[model samples]
Target: MVKQPAPDTTRRSEKSRRAIYDAALALVGEVGYPKTTIEGIAARAGVGKQTIYRWWSSKAEVLMEAFLDLGEQSAREAGQESYAFPDTGDLAADLKAVLRATVDELRDPRFEVPSRALAAEGVVNEQLGRELVAKLLEPSLQLYVDRLRTAQDTGEVRQDIDPRIALELFVSPLAQRWLQHTGPIDHTYTDTLVDYALYGLAPR
Candidate 1:
Protein backbone atom coordinates (compact mmCIF):
# COMPACT_ATOMS: atom_id res chain seq x y z
CA MET A 1 0.00 0.00 0.00
CA VAL A 2 1.28 3.48 -0.93
CA LYS A 3 1.02 6.13 1.75
CA GLN A 4 0.03 9.66 0.78
CA PRO A 5 1.91 12.65 2.21
CA ALA A 6 -0.13 14.39 4.90
CA PRO A 7 -1.64 17.67 3.66
CA ASP A 8 0.37 20.54 5.10
CA THR A 9 -1.19 23.53 6.88
CA THR A 10 -0.35 25.93 4.00
CA ARG A 11 -2.00 23.70 1.42
CA ARG A 12 -5.08 23.24 3.60
CA SER A 13 -5.27 26.97 4.28
CA GLU A 14 -5.00 27.81 0.58
CA LYS A 15 -7.78 25.34 -0.27
CA SER A 16 -9.95 26.93 2.42
CA ARG A 17 -9.18 30.41 1.08
CA ARG A 18 -10.16 29.45 -2.47
CA ALA A 19 -13.33 27.88 -1.19
CA ILE A 20 -14.10 31.08 0.72
CA TYR A 21 -13.65 33.22 -2.39
CA ASP A 22 -15.82 30.94 -4.51
CA ALA A 23 -18.52 30.82 -1.86
CA ALA A 24 -18.55 34.57 -1.38
CA LEU A 25 -18.90 35.24 -5.12
CA ALA A 26 -21.59 32.63 -5.72
CA LEU A 27 -23.56 33.62 -2.61
CA VAL A 28 -23.57 37.30 -3.51
CA GLY A 29 -24.52 36.50 -7.10
CA GLU A 30 -27.38 34.27 -6.01
CA VAL A 31 -28.54 36.25 -2.96
CA GLY A 32 -27.47 39.86 -3.39
CA TYR A 33 -24.79 41.65 -1.34
CA PRO A 34 -26.96 42.65 1.61
CA LYS A 35 -27.96 39.04 2.32
CA THR A 36 -24.49 37.50 1.97
CA THR A 37 -23.17 37.07 5.53
CA ILE A 38 -19.88 35.70 6.78
CA GLU A 39 -21.67 32.82 8.48
CA GLY A 40 -23.39 31.97 5.22
CA ILE A 41 -20.13 32.12 3.30
CA ALA A 42 -18.50 29.89 5.95
CA ALA A 43 -21.33 27.37 5.69
CA ARG A 44 -21.15 27.40 1.91
CA ALA A 45 -17.36 27.15 2.00
CA GLY A 46 -17.49 24.31 4.57
CA VAL A 47 -15.17 26.21 6.90
CA GLY A 48 -15.76 27.62 10.38
CA LYS A 49 -17.03 31.21 10.61
CA GLN A 50 -13.97 32.06 12.72
CA THR A 51 -11.76 31.21 9.75
CA ILE A 52 -13.41 34.01 7.76
CA TYR A 53 -13.21 36.48 10.64
CA ARG A 54 -9.51 35.75 10.99
CA TRP A 55 -8.90 36.73 7.37
CA TRP A 56 -11.38 39.54 6.75
CA SER A 57 -12.85 42.30 8.88
CA SER A 58 -16.20 42.30 7.09
CA LYS A 59 -18.29 40.71 4.37
CA ALA A 60 -17.63 43.75 2.17
CA GLU A 61 -13.89 43.12 2.41
CA VAL A 62 -14.30 39.43 1.57
CA LEU A 63 -16.55 40.15 -1.42
CA MET A 64 -14.19 42.81 -2.72
CA GLU A 65 -11.23 40.42 -2.59
CA ALA A 66 -13.27 37.66 -4.20
CA PHE A 67 -14.29 39.90 -7.10
CA LEU A 68 -10.72 41.06 -7.59
CA ASP A 69 -9.51 37.48 -7.55
CA LEU A 70 -12.17 36.48 -10.03
CA GLY A 71 -10.96 39.18 -12.46
CA GLU A 72 -7.36 38.01 -12.10
CA GLN A 73 -8.37 34.37 -12.62
CA SER A 74 -10.33 35.22 -15.75
CA ALA A 75 -7.38 37.14 -17.12
CA ARG A 76 -5.01 34.24 -16.41
CA GLU A 77 -7.35 31.72 -18.03
CA ALA A 78 -7.63 34.01 -21.05
CA GLY A 79 -3.81 34.15 -21.28
CA GLN A 80 -3.66 37.93 -20.81
CA GLU A 81 -2.35 40.24 -18.14
CA SER A 82 -5.13 41.60 -15.92
CA TYR A 83 -6.04 45.13 -17.08
CA ALA A 84 -2.93 45.47 -19.22
CA PHE A 85 -4.67 47.48 -21.92
CA PRO A 86 -3.29 46.89 -25.37
CA ASP A 87 -1.43 49.78 -27.03
CA THR A 88 -0.54 48.70 -30.54
CA GLY A 89 0.03 52.28 -31.85
CA ASP A 90 -3.20 52.19 -33.86
CA LEU A 91 -5.27 53.63 -31.05
CA ALA A 92 -8.70 52.89 -32.56
CA ALA A 93 -7.87 49.26 -33.26
CA ASP A 94 -6.50 48.82 -29.75
CA LEU A 95 -9.54 50.40 -28.15
CA LYS A 96 -11.85 48.27 -30.28
CA ALA A 97 -10.08 45.07 -29.27
CA VAL A 98 -10.24 45.91 -25.59
CA LEU A 99 -13.89 46.99 -25.76
CA ARG A 100 -14.85 43.86 -27.65
CA ALA A 101 -13.27 41.80 -24.90
CA THR A 102 -15.16 43.87 -22.35
CA VAL A 103 -18.40 43.13 -24.19
CA ASP A 104 -17.70 39.42 -23.93
CA GLU A 105 -16.77 39.69 -20.24
CA LEU A 106 -19.83 41.77 -19.41
CA ARG A 107 -22.07 39.17 -21.01
CA ASP A 108 -20.43 36.22 -19.25
CA PRO A 109 -22.61 34.80 -16.49
CA ARG A 110 -19.76 34.16 -14.07
CA PHE A 111 -18.69 37.80 -14.11
CA GLU A 112 -21.96 39.55 -14.90
CA VAL A 113 -24.04 37.89 -12.19
CA PRO A 114 -21.82 38.77 -9.24
CA SER A 115 -20.85 42.15 -10.72
CA ARG A 116 -24.48 43.15 -11.12
CA ALA A 117 -25.13 42.29 -7.47
CA LEU A 118 -22.17 44.34 -6.26
CA ALA A 119 -22.85 47.24 -8.63
CA ALA A 120 -26.44 47.52 -7.44
CA GLU A 121 -25.40 47.40 -3.80
CA GLY A 122 -22.68 49.95 -4.40
CA VAL A 123 -25.25 52.46 -5.61
CA VAL A 124 -26.75 52.51 -2.10
CA ASN A 125 -23.64 51.89 -0.02
CA GLU A 126 -21.47 54.98 -0.48
CA GLN A 127 -18.36 53.52 1.12
CA LEU A 128 -18.64 50.24 -0.76
CA GLY A 129 -19.19 52.17 -4.00
CA ARG A 130 -16.13 54.32 -3.41
CA GLU A 131 -14.00 51.30 -2.55
CA LEU A 132 -15.22 49.43 -5.65
CA VAL A 133 -14.21 52.37 -7.87
CA ALA A 134 -10.94 52.94 -6.02
CA LYS A 135 -9.92 49.32 -5.80
CA LEU A 136 -11.03 48.03 -9.22
CA LEU A 137 -12.65 50.42 -11.72
CA GLU A 138 -10.28 53.40 -11.40
CA PRO A 139 -7.15 51.34 -11.97
CA SER A 140 -8.54 50.02 -15.26
CA LEU A 141 -9.73 53.50 -16.27
CA GLN A 142 -6.27 54.89 -15.64
CA LEU A 143 -4.94 52.45 -18.19
CA TYR A 144 -7.20 54.04 -20.80
CA VAL A 145 -6.05 57.49 -19.76
CA ASP A 146 -2.45 56.44 -20.17
CA ARG A 147 -3.13 55.00 -23.60
CA LEU A 148 -4.92 58.16 -24.68
CA ARG A 149 -2.03 60.25 -23.46
CA THR A 150 0.31 58.18 -25.60
CA ALA A 151 -2.02 58.73 -28.56
CA GLN A 152 -1.91 62.47 -27.93
CA ASP A 153 1.90 62.42 -27.96
CA THR A 154 1.83 60.53 -31.24
CA GLY A 155 -0.61 63.10 -32.75
CA GLU A 156 -3.37 60.51 -33.10
CA VAL A 157 -5.55 62.27 -30.54
CA ARG A 158 -5.83 66.07 -30.23
CA GLN A 159 -3.24 67.66 -27.92
CA ASP A 160 -5.75 69.52 -25.75
CA ILE A 161 -8.05 66.51 -25.14
CA ASP A 162 -8.31 65.50 -21.50
CA PRO A 163 -7.53 61.81 -21.71
CA ARG A 164 -9.55 61.05 -18.61
CA ILE A 165 -12.78 62.64 -19.83
CA ALA A 166 -12.14 61.70 -23.46
CA LEU A 167 -11.95 58.02 -22.52
CA GLU A 168 -15.43 58.22 -20.98
CA LEU A 169 -16.88 59.19 -24.37
CA PHE A 170 -16.51 55.60 -25.55
CA VAL A 171 -16.15 53.68 -22.31
CA SER A 172 -19.16 55.12 -20.50
CA PRO A 173 -21.64 54.32 -23.29
CA LEU A 174 -20.71 50.64 -23.34
CA ALA A 175 -20.83 50.49 -19.56
CA GLN A 176 -24.27 52.07 -19.61
CA ARG A 177 -25.55 49.46 -22.07
CA TRP A 178 -24.21 46.63 -19.91
CA LEU A 179 -25.32 47.99 -16.53
CA GLN A 180 -28.68 49.40 -17.62
CA HIS A 181 -29.61 46.86 -20.32
CA THR A 182 -30.22 49.78 -22.64
CA GLY A 183 -28.95 47.84 -25.65
CA PRO A 184 -27.14 44.71 -26.71
CA ILE A 185 -23.34 44.59 -26.34
CA ASP A 186 -21.24 42.95 -29.00
CA HIS A 187 -18.00 43.37 -30.95
CA THR A 188 -19.73 45.34 -33.70
CA TYR A 189 -21.25 47.78 -31.19
CA THR A 190 -17.92 48.39 -29.50
CA ASP A 191 -16.18 48.80 -32.88
CA THR A 192 -18.72 51.41 -33.81
CA LEU A 193 -18.09 53.21 -30.52
CA VAL A 194 -14.37 53.39 -31.24
CA ASP A 195 -15.02 54.73 -34.76
CA TYR A 196 -17.48 57.37 -33.63
CA ALA A 197 -15.26 58.38 -30.73
CA LEU A 198 -12.22 58.80 -32.95
CA TYR A 199 -14.00 60.56 -35.83
CA GLY A 200 -16.49 63.34 -35.31
CA LEU A 201 -19.99 63.45 -36.86
CA ALA A 202 -18.99 66.42 -39.13
CA PRO A 203 -18.56 65.63 -42.80
CA ARG A 204 -15.12 66.00 -44.44
Candidate 2:
Protein backbone atom coordinates (compact mmCIF):
# COMPACT_ATOMS: atom_id res chain seq x y z
CA MET A 1 0.00 0.00 0.00
CA VAL A 2 1.27 3.43 -0.93
CA LYS A 3 1.35 5.82 2.01
CA GLN A 4 0.46 9.49 1.41
CA PRO A 5 2.12 12.20 3.44
CA ALA A 6 0.01 14.17 5.91
CA PRO A 7 -0.57 17.84 5.33
CA ASP A 8 2.30 20.07 6.50
CA THR A 9 0.82 22.57 8.92
CA THR A 10 4.17 24.26 9.35
CA ARG A 11 4.42 24.87 5.61
CA ARG A 12 0.86 26.13 5.57
CA SER A 13 1.59 28.54 8.41
CA GLU A 14 4.71 29.81 6.66
CA LYS A 15 2.76 30.44 3.47
CA SER A 16 0.10 32.30 5.42
CA ARG A 17 2.72 34.36 7.23
CA ARG A 18 4.42 35.29 3.95
CA ALA A 19 1.07 36.28 2.44
CA ILE A 20 0.33 38.48 5.46
CA TYR A 21 3.72 40.14 5.11
CA ASP A 22 3.20 40.80 1.42
CA ALA A 23 -0.28 42.23 2.06
CA ALA A 24 0.97 44.49 4.84
CA LEU A 25 3.87 45.86 2.74
CA ALA A 26 1.70 46.39 -0.33
CA LEU A 27 -1.09 48.08 1.63
CA VAL A 28 1.27 50.42 3.45
CA GLY A 29 3.00 51.30 0.20
CA GLU A 30 -0.29 51.89 -1.61
CA VAL A 31 -2.24 53.61 1.17
CA GLY A 32 0.41 54.81 3.62
CA TYR A 33 0.64 53.85 7.29
CA PRO A 34 -1.98 56.22 8.66
CA LYS A 35 -4.73 54.57 6.59
CA THR A 36 -3.50 50.95 6.59
CA THR A 37 -5.35 48.62 8.93
CA ILE A 38 -5.07 45.04 10.22
CA GLU A 39 -8.48 44.22 8.71
CA GLY A 40 -7.32 45.54 5.37
CA ILE A 41 -4.16 43.45 5.56
CA ALA A 42 -6.20 40.34 6.38
CA ALA A 43 -8.53 40.96 3.47
CA ARG A 44 -5.70 41.55 1.05
CA ALA A 45 -3.84 38.54 2.37
CA GLY A 46 -6.90 36.26 2.04
CA VAL A 47 -6.59 35.30 5.69
CA GLY A 48 -8.59 35.96 8.84
CA LYS A 49 -7.68 38.79 11.22
CA GLN A 50 -7.32 36.13 13.89
CA THR A 51 -4.49 34.55 11.90
CA ILE A 52 -2.52 37.77 12.10
CA TYR A 53 -3.50 38.34 15.73
CA ARG A 54 -2.10 34.92 16.56
CA TRP A 55 1.33 36.06 15.41
CA TRP A 56 1.39 39.79 16.12
CA SER A 57 -0.29 42.18 18.48
CA SER A 58 -0.95 45.16 16.21
CA LYS A 59 -0.65 46.62 12.70
CA ALA A 60 2.61 48.35 13.55
CA GLU A 61 4.18 45.08 14.63
CA VAL A 62 3.06 43.35 11.43
CA LEU A 63 4.31 46.17 9.23
CA MET A 64 7.68 46.28 10.97
CA GLU A 65 8.10 42.53 10.65
CA ALA A 66 7.09 42.71 7.00
CA PHE A 67 9.84 45.25 6.32
CA LEU A 68 12.35 43.12 8.16
CA ASP A 69 11.35 40.09 6.07
CA LEU A 70 11.61 42.16 2.92
CA GLY A 71 15.17 43.16 3.79
CA GLU A 72 16.15 39.60 4.59
CA GLN A 73 14.54 38.32 1.40
CA SER A 74 16.38 40.90 -0.64
CA ALA A 75 19.61 39.96 1.04
CA ARG A 76 19.01 36.31 0.25
CA GLU A 77 18.28 37.10 -3.37
CA ALA A 78 21.50 39.12 -3.63
CA GLY A 79 23.54 36.39 -1.91
CA GLN A 80 24.70 38.94 0.64
CA GLU A 81 24.65 38.56 4.38
CA SER A 82 22.11 40.97 5.83
CA TYR A 83 23.51 43.53 8.32
CA ALA A 84 27.11 42.34 7.92
CA PHE A 85 29.60 44.85 6.62
CA PRO A 86 31.78 43.57 3.85
CA ASP A 87 35.48 43.13 4.62
CA THR A 88 37.86 42.98 1.67
CA GLY A 89 41.01 44.23 3.51
CA ASP A 90 40.53 47.55 1.67
CA LEU A 91 38.06 49.64 3.66
CA ALA A 92 37.33 52.09 0.84
CA ALA A 93 36.44 49.38 -1.65
CA ASP A 94 34.30 47.59 0.91
CA LEU A 95 32.37 50.68 1.95
CA LYS A 96 31.78 51.67 -1.63
CA ALA A 97 30.47 48.24 -2.47
CA VAL A 98 28.02 48.26 0.41
CA LEU A 99 26.86 51.78 -0.40
CA ARG A 100 26.25 50.78 -4.01
CA ALA A 101 24.13 47.89 -2.82
CA THR A 102 22.27 50.31 -0.56
CA VAL A 103 21.66 52.59 -3.52
CA ASP A 104 20.24 49.65 -5.43
CA GLU A 105 17.91 48.83 -2.50
CA LEU A 106 16.75 52.43 -2.19
CA ARG A 107 16.00 52.51 -5.91
CA ASP A 108 13.75 49.46 -5.78
CA PRO A 109 10.05 50.36 -5.63
CA ARG A 110 9.22 47.47 -3.31
CA PHE A 111 11.58 48.97 -0.75
CA GLU A 112 11.31 52.70 -1.46
CA VAL A 113 7.51 52.99 -1.43
CA PRO A 114 6.91 51.21 1.85
CA SER A 115 10.05 52.77 3.31
CA ARG A 116 8.85 56.30 2.60
CA ALA A 117 5.48 55.49 4.11
CA LEU A 118 7.16 54.12 7.21
CA ALA A 119 9.58 57.04 7.42
CA ALA A 120 6.71 59.49 7.31
CA GLU A 121 4.81 57.67 10.04
CA GLY A 122 7.94 57.28 12.13
CA VAL A 123 8.43 61.02 12.05
CA VAL A 124 5.16 61.52 13.93
CA ASN A 125 4.75 58.32 15.93
CA GLU A 126 7.50 58.50 18.50
CA GLN A 127 7.22 54.94 19.73
CA LEU A 128 6.97 53.43 16.28
CA GLY A 129 9.87 55.60 15.13
CA ARG A 130 12.05 54.48 18.00
CA GLU A 131 11.18 50.86 17.47
CA LEU A 132 11.89 51.09 13.76
CA VAL A 133 15.26 52.72 14.41
CA ALA A 134 16.15 50.20 17.06
CA LYS A 135 15.14 47.20 15.00
CA LEU A 136 15.78 48.11 11.37
CA LEU A 137 18.23 50.99 11.33
CA GLU A 138 20.62 50.82 14.27
CA PRO A 139 21.93 47.33 13.56
CA SER A 140 23.14 48.31 10.12
CA LEU A 141 24.75 51.44 11.55
CA GLN A 142 26.46 49.31 14.15
CA LEU A 143 28.01 47.26 11.40
CA TYR A 144 29.57 50.43 10.03
CA VAL A 145 30.81 51.39 13.48
CA ASP A 146 32.38 47.98 13.87
CA ARG A 147 34.04 48.19 10.48
CA LEU A 148 35.37 51.68 11.27
CA ARG A 149 36.75 50.48 14.57
CA THR A 150 38.59 47.74 12.70
CA ALA A 151 40.00 50.40 10.35
CA GLN A 152 41.25 52.33 13.38
CA ASP A 153 43.00 49.25 14.73
CA THR A 154 44.65 48.74 11.35
CA GLY A 155 45.86 52.38 11.23
CA GLU A 156 43.55 52.99 8.29
CA VAL A 157 41.48 55.42 10.36
CA ARG A 158 42.38 57.77 13.19
CA GLN A 159 42.14 56.21 16.63
CA ASP A 160 40.89 59.44 18.18
CA ILE A 161 37.90 59.57 15.82
CA ASP A 162 34.54 58.43 17.09
CA PRO A 163 33.44 55.66 14.74
CA ARG A 164 29.78 56.55 15.19
CA ILE A 165 30.19 60.21 14.26
CA ALA A 166 32.83 59.48 11.60
CA LEU A 167 30.43 57.10 9.82
CA GLU A 168 27.93 59.92 9.39
CA LEU A 169 30.19 61.74 6.94
CA PHE A 170 29.44 59.23 4.21
CA VAL A 171 26.27 57.56 5.44
CA SER A 172 24.25 60.62 6.34
CA PRO A 173 24.83 62.41 3.05
CA LEU A 174 23.64 59.45 1.00
CA ALA A 175 20.62 58.98 3.27
CA GLN A 176 19.70 62.65 3.06
CA ARG A 177 19.99 62.56 -0.70
CA TRP A 178 17.74 59.55 -1.02
CA LEU A 179 15.19 60.63 1.60
CA GLN A 180 14.88 64.21 0.40
CA HIS A 181 15.36 63.73 -3.38
CA THR A 182 17.95 66.45 -3.06
CA GLY A 183 20.08 64.90 -5.80
CA PRO A 184 20.59 61.88 -7.99
CA ILE A 185 22.03 58.67 -6.54
CA ASP A 186 24.06 56.09 -8.39
CA HIS A 187 27.24 54.05 -8.11
CA THR A 188 29.43 56.93 -9.11
CA TYR A 189 27.85 59.19 -6.51
CA THR A 190 28.26 56.63 -3.76
CA ASP A 191 31.81 55.85 -4.83
CA THR A 192 32.64 59.53 -4.74
CA LEU A 193 31.16 59.85 -1.26
CA VAL A 194 33.41 57.04 -0.05
CA ASP A 195 36.51 58.59 -1.62
CA TYR A 196 35.73 62.02 -0.24
CA ALA A 197 35.03 60.71 3.22
CA LEU A 198 38.24 58.75 3.36
CA TYR A 199 40.54 61.22 1.55
CA GLY A 200 38.89 64.59 2.26
CA LEU A 201 38.77 67.58 -0.14
CA ALA A 202 42.42 68.64 0.26
CA PRO A 203 44.69 67.76 -2.60
CA ARG A 204 47.33 65.10 -2.02
| lDDT of candidates 1 onward, in order | 0.89, 0.90
Q: Which residue pairs of candidate 2 clash?
A: none
For residues 1-204, what per-residue lDDT tens digits would candidate 2 score against the true structure? Answer: 112223555888889989999999999999999899999999999999998887888898898888888999999999977777788889999999999999999999999999999998998999989988988898889999999999998999988999999889988999999888999999999999999999889998
lDDT of 1 at 10: 86
**Total clashes, candidate 1?**
0
lDDT of 2 at 68: 86
Candidate 1 worst ten-residue window by lDDT: 1-10
TM-score of 2: 0.93
For candidate 2, the per-residue lDDT at 45 reads: 99
User: Where does model 2 exceed 4 Å of error?
Assistant: 1-9
Model 2 CA lDDT for position 109: 95
lDDT of 1: 0.89
